[model samples]
Target: PRPTQQTQTFIPNTSGGNLPEITSELLNSYIHSSQWHFIKQLAPKITPSLITSALLDLHKNPDLAFQFINHLGFRRIRDIKTRCIAIAVISGLSTSKPTLQLLKETLNSGIATIQVVFNELAVARDELRIRSSTVFDFLLRVCCELKRDDDAFKCFYMMKEKGFVPKIESCNDMLSMFVKLNRPYKAWVLYAEMFRMRIKSSVCTFNIMINLLCKEGKLQKAKDFLGFMESLGIKPNIVTYNTIVHGYCLSGRIEGARLVLNAMKSRGVQPDSYTYGSFVSGMCKEGRLEEASRMLEQMKENGLVPTAVTYNTLIDGYCNKGNLEMAFSFRDEMVKQGIMPTASTYNLLIHELLMERKMVEADDMLKEMGEKGIVPDSITYNILINGYCRCGNAKKAFSLHDEMIHKGMLPDIVMFNALIDGHCTNGNIERAFSLLKEMDRMKVHPDEVTYNTLMHGRCRQGKVEEARRLLDQMKRRGIKPDHISFNPTRLTYNALIQGLCKNQEGDLAEELLREMVSKGITPDDNTYFSLIEGIASVDKAAESSNS
Candidate 1:
């Protein structure tokens, strides 16, 4: 069979301007054409499409096209569309190998750099007063579209310096780029410049600012901006409400989000999936699953389908609460509805199973995840290692830790702490110290929890002096050996005190009590009650049998 050659059809402009078919010969005829000769010859008859075709034909030798276009000038090409297309052709060629070669040649010349040449080209648009600004606008728009933001920024200020108003859309793109890069301050500077330039602010511009304010946790300011929007006669769209709602939800101001939701209704704007998703996510984070479920029902009533993310939130919340059955049930439900479970879904289930010490079940979940085409990541390995450590199977834990490293996953401090505490609990103090040495070699600084775990282990083994030394080491590390700083809660102190009392070390227990009081950690009723019982048990004081 003969191979069929693929061909493309050229479509002419709908307007009176027909796309000219310019061949090499047609373009070559203009090689010796004098300055203004081609412009005067093709006057009134030349269209943007024709000029574009001529430039494309001369793309190999871009200098001819550039020099010729420069000579023709914006005044001669009075059609704004013609001037834009003429520059558009050059912009398209700017990425080509031939064009880049020409650029390098042009830049290598000490007399003028590529930037200088472009600057000269950019300013030539000001030759005619009316078409001047539009020329730079065209150039700026092209620069932004090509992701030449640096050039776009320079051109923007150049327009301001030259009194030529750059394109408002280009300025907005620049602002959008800054916000996306998390340089909200830069966005603000550009926005202020827009104000100084008297450029009309679009709704998109205000929405970007509102989102930035929301991300910065300035909820009240974000909401106040809504009034500013309405005051300027710019009505709030669904996106505007959604951004504020999401912000409020993330800030744990679910109640405020409800107010925004009501405001959206009052303004005749319908809440979308994003609004409901944000509320559900916040509720799930607070372990308010029942309310999240109610919101889920509300979402369905509104005819919006919950995304996988929505289901993941519920699943994770249930998993954290030890409601594994419900978590798996939601996973099944999401699958039944054609929303396949993601790796996060399996991660939650596996972590909970590991926490419960159901190693067999966790292994089964790993296999299931593999069958479902979900790859286990670092979190999966960490959970498995912690699970083995909890089972006192240090060998298995070390094996999994090695596997994680082999798979390019670096062991973090959490993994090391788990191993260290595991060895300490098994009374393998030498092995624990070796792991600490390895941690130091890896440059993973031991956190307060790590030190606290070691201290509790030593205190359990009646090595009070060693445990006390660890506390001093913690202070030397610049980590204040405070009650809360040692561990996240008061449990560490209570456990240490109980262990000391059980070992007949009432004096140390009293010292800990005094230290707790001196540090201003108010002893709760349970803390005092535990301490009294510990002292009585340690002193072997017989209680009355009459009761």
Candidate 2:
């Protein structure tokens, strides 16, 4: 017979629970025989306090305690103390999966702050007399997985403060998160902390640091880091070689990338698809298309299949160079090689078609995309929207915009800019302003092109004051005119000056020309022409008024 249910010996953790009491012995008996259905019958009688007491009684038997917790259900075990004790029991098992999972749930539940959870975990760990740091490590692992860097850092240093050195894997997890978050300085700080704590670094750790260095444009430092890892007896894997190769290629140093490639090959590390892909991308960027094609062939000879990205790189290069015939040929070759075209592939081809003003061909490509069941992503829609806008088809462009939204795709700033430019081109300045307002409502911050388009539109409508105000608003929003692409900026200024001059504001036009020059933007011939024409007209007006 089961042990008799005891009288209420423990108070509830919360006011709502008036749970019937079952002693640990009875709970333990029901759990021992795998009679979970019997224990579950007492669920209406169960509270966090009862569960914690039962867990403490079964601390020596973590498996049964875990089973009991699972039977009662984690959702019922809502309190922090109960969850923490449950986690501590699970941590006693050889595998950390259940422990990590429970900790992740606890953290994600948002019922308790990370600090409260950590505090409870520490207390539970000490009460259970478990000497392993597995629970803390799991906590950090969960934090890293959640991308909660600050919480992970708190848990890490908290463990260190309590004289518990986290394992290398935990440190690496946090380090990897910091790198992914693009917080390089924080990553380096954590690395230095790891060094100070004498936690041995792993290949994964060194790889993350190398990636960080490459992202920071310290390619040489990244290479030297490889030698540093070797000194520490950690061998470089294929990922290590690929990282440096990618960095070199991205920096336009083909010879440097080739040196790394040869070094990897000498070390018996055969180049993979990514290794060759970098070279293909580099060669394409340098306009060596034929060589890139040959490299793709070389990749196939080495039993490596090139990805759609590799082919897309070549197609984009050809498209940029106005070689549509070759671009289409490569697209056909990819299909022949059994590599189906991705939405990106169709996007590239359709974009090029539109760039060549072959609207019919572009539409045909879009139809092919649908036939292949390749759904158009945001880039595809942006391409088509911009294309139709350029062709003075605002009605069609707007129709596509509605279709995009109906398809659950949010219009990006590029789409908005294209629409604004189209409205401006069609002399629909009021509609352009409406779009700008819509951008504000959607919280899409306008870039320089956005403001530039509006400013030009205002100038075109002879609203010179409003145009000047937009430039001021742009400055106030901290969006500077793009100095790299000075032509558009120079055009904006010329339009504004011409508008001012037409309003017989020659002095303001000259002042703006001086401002343009002072900003190191040379006044082009159109700039000088606007000023000259303005001054001549103003002089003629003054003489006519005197007559």
User: What TM-scores do the predictions have?
Assistant: 0.65, 0.86
For model 2, the run of ten residues with the poorest summed lDDT: 1-10
Candidate 2 Cα deviation (angstroms), residue 511: 6.0
Q: Give candidates' CA RMSD values in order.
A: 12.9, 4.8
lDDT of 2 by residue, 1-547 (tens): 1123434432323543554567667776777788987666677667566677778778888888778877777855667877888899888887778788888888887879988998888999888888887889999999999999999999988999989999999999998999999888889999999999999999999989999998998999999999999998998999999999999988888899989999889888999999999999999999888988999999999999988899999999999999999999989989998999999899988998888899999989999998999999999999999999988888889899989989988888899999999999999999999998988888777777888888888988888999998877766666344322223367678888988988889989988888888777787888888888888999999999999
Model 1, 1-547: lDDT tens per residue?
A: 1112212222222343444554445544765364356444443444444555565455455457766666544334433333433453454443443333333333333344325545644533322122434445555555545555566677777778777776667677787777777877777888899998888887888888899999899999999999998999999999999999999989888999999999999999999988999999999887789999899889989999999999999999899899999998999989988998888888889889988888899889989988988888888888888888987888888888888888888788889999988888888877887887888778777777788787777877877677767767765666544322343235556656766776767788889878877767777776677678877875555454433
lDDT of 1 at 324: 94
The residue-level lDDT of candidate 2 at 317 comes to 93
> For each candidate, what is the lDDT?
0.72, 0.86
Best model per TM-score? 2
Off by over 4 Å in 2: 1-20, 35-41, 110-116, 458-490, 503-522, 538-547
